[model samples]
Target: MTRDTPHLWTEQKLDARYENLFGRAAGYLPENRAALDAWLDDFSRDVHERRARNAIVRHPSVADLARLIERDRIVRMYVSRMINEAHQRDCKNTVNDIPDLLDHLDCIVTSTPKYQGPTAFPMSALFTYLMMTTDGYAVFRDQGFNKALLGILREWCAHLDSKDSQEVLNQKNGWLSPAALADKKLNLQDFQINLQDPYGGFPSFNAFFHRELRKDKDVRPIDDPDDPRIIVSANDGKVVRIRRDIKRSDEFWAKGQRYSLYDMLDGSDLTDLFVGGDVFQSFLSGGDYHRWHAPVSGVVRSARVVEALMFTELEHTSGRDAGTESQVYGASVNTRGLVFIECPPPIGMVCVMPLGMTEISSVTLTVQPGDQVTKGQEMGYFSYGGSSMCLLFQKGAIEKFFPKDNTGDMEEGDPIKVNARIAQAVGDEA
Candidate 1:
């Protein structure tokens, strides 16, 4: 049926996209298409009835279907999940949707079909899962999102202690050293020495205050499980934010832009590791795809053959401070042949990397020198998601990260919102 068009979305693509997503989501449903259809028909009628019955409930309406369906309990369960996932890709403001979604949860839950074996995802549980995925801080901006997110944290996490980080924060029981501090969004000052941080010998009151640590982490100095954030926002100091292409070596930082992409990573195409990036978070592992897949699929072209590499690592190795959006994509290396994730047509390669609490701490990749890879295969695992992957383009390849209407370039250290085009990959061959 008719769908709402986002400022960035095209009217023409909505039908096709929704249909395509429905098809893919349908895979998670039963093989019996008839049963699925029947469940949907009843689900829509139920939602309509609820609107008539009560106005305070929040649920998803199964209306606007291209075709009718008469689904079973199992079918209804899957449909609820599918609807929730579709909205996560692009949220909609249906005042009635939430209550309706929550209402059906009880009706469809039961120990029916199992995913692998014993662990079953029932309707109510799946509804909760979908709710968690979509109920992120919405309708907010930079600070608002931060405040709202932090509130959610307070609701779900424990209270933090100090935020004034002068030295390297101690690793807590299960929290990063620096996190919430970055969220304070405060400016830094000069002449203030944090006698704690041990960076390069040079010290000039690090312009970007708290650049070393963030306040978003759990500030469990001793062992406070109730700490909401690793680092507290109210008590933390400032951090320094360096742009992409940051280099410890003077030569590289001064003249990195001069050299072409090939020279940056120091390798060639023919290799086994095709893709590599900072392991901010993962869906397969821990919502990794949610952080990377959108930008990857948006502008990547079909002409170039591509492989996928997911790097898993601990948060401390990347030196990522809290409050700063974690990077999930970075400079991917290719030591062997020029085999890499090709640049999406016209939109070079869009990288979605969220480097966590560690940017540097001596980490190693569990991958060999050369290995072939598929688009979504794993290459190696790092301690944290702190590495980088480069979007490779052969000698005569085109690089694209931005769409014409939108300019979402992957310029070193920029946050990528969903549906934002990062780059484009288009060359002579493209």
Candidate 2:
């Protein structure tokens, strides 16, 4: 079960990619330093000091490792061929203005040095904070940028739809083969994969990324359907934060960055429904499953998509913004969708929000409004990169999360499966 040698993405290439990206983005900003300009000065200074003192180490802490255990397990369970499968289909006819950007995407899902080195949180934080400060979010929000990025993703998606992609995946020892690809990443025996098709029964990387598993009692069994109190995980990801007594406006960032309920809900009429609710947020890593499922068996009341910034991690490498939590704010500014589900009785209404980040910004909704959905039923998925999901409960609707203490408070979630019990209803008033 040893892994095959990987085609590594070196740090040199990553830095070069960042340099090019920053240069390109800088051109889009105005010479006038908006309000965020003054803020960046303080932010930059703080980050510089931290790096000078070597405050952040690249390696995971004991806590981080504990949380990453689930993340690593999930990665080992799946093949790395999902994104690589993009190479199999013909994209010659499609217009790809940034062909090189494809390699950047490849680098992400491929290899991470065995040792991730020091935490890049400060820099990550600075970039995310800056975007929020200077309306940098607005720059990435432009249609020109979004259309181009979407076009690139669409090209990759189209390739996944091609027979050629499947043929490559079916190959015995080819680079695109899932078996061989799996060898390059992690031992395949650690988990299960349906290899019914030559290409492992996956049409493309997209299909592979969102692959469903054969029914098993352990992987992610839905709780007793008759029990209306059970709530399942909306997706396979690390729980980032869990909070009770969420107010209409709340701080979501380091040093108290504030976001309003109206802004997060896109000014919907139902905003008041969650005024004093509880909020649960989790982030999907690059290696995690992208598909989302119903957390509760309920009738879909509404589903709406919102367009927002594409790149939320837009900062330099040297500063406090480089902190690992820097991209934390991206969940609020990034393009996302909101799903309103009306629980049969005592539970009332529950809201699930899926937000996109960086290259993984596309959110696809599979279920429509008014559809009756069973707990753990398919809801939607993120297309290409890491993203986050938020579950909003009315004031006291949640009694507790499954395994109670196994949440991702330290590093990530407990590698919970789709359809697995995540929370229980308290039958409280909406």
- Per-candidate TM-scores read 0.23, 0.61
Judge candidate 1 at residue 229 and give its lDDT. 14
Residue by residue across 1-430, what tens digits does model 1's lDDT show?
2333334334334333322221112122222333333444455465467557673332122221101113234333434444555454453322134335444432222112221211121231222223222222111112322232223222211111112221222322111123312322221121122425442221221122222222354221211212211111111111112233322222321212212233333433322122321111111111111112122222222222122211111121111121122122122211111222333344333222222211111122222223322232222322211223233323222233232211111121333222222332343432
Model 1 TM-score, all chains together: 0.23
Task: Tell me the tens digit of each residue's lDDT in model 2 across 1-430.
Answer: 2322223324343334333332112212212223223433444454345556765333222223223324454421221231232222221111122222222222222221111112111122223322322234333445544554444444445544455455434446532344554662323332345655566656665565555544553555686667788887887765655667666755544332233566677777888888877766666654556788998978988998887765655333322223223334555566888999998656789988998665553688998899999887889988655477778888677788764332222233455566777788876433
lDDT of 2: 0.53
- Shift in Å, residue 31, candidate 2: 35
- RMSD vs true structure, all candidates: 22.2, 16.9
Question: lDDT per model, in order?
Answer: 0.25, 0.53
What's model 2's lDDT at 323?
A: 22
| Candidate 2 residue 198 C-alpha distance from true site, Å | 2.4
Supply candidate 2's per-residue lDDT for 305.
88
* Superposition error at 370 for model 1 (Å): 7.4
Give candidate 2's error at residue 199 in angstroms: 1.1
Superposition-based RMSD of candidate 2 using all C-alpha atoms, in angstroms? 16.9
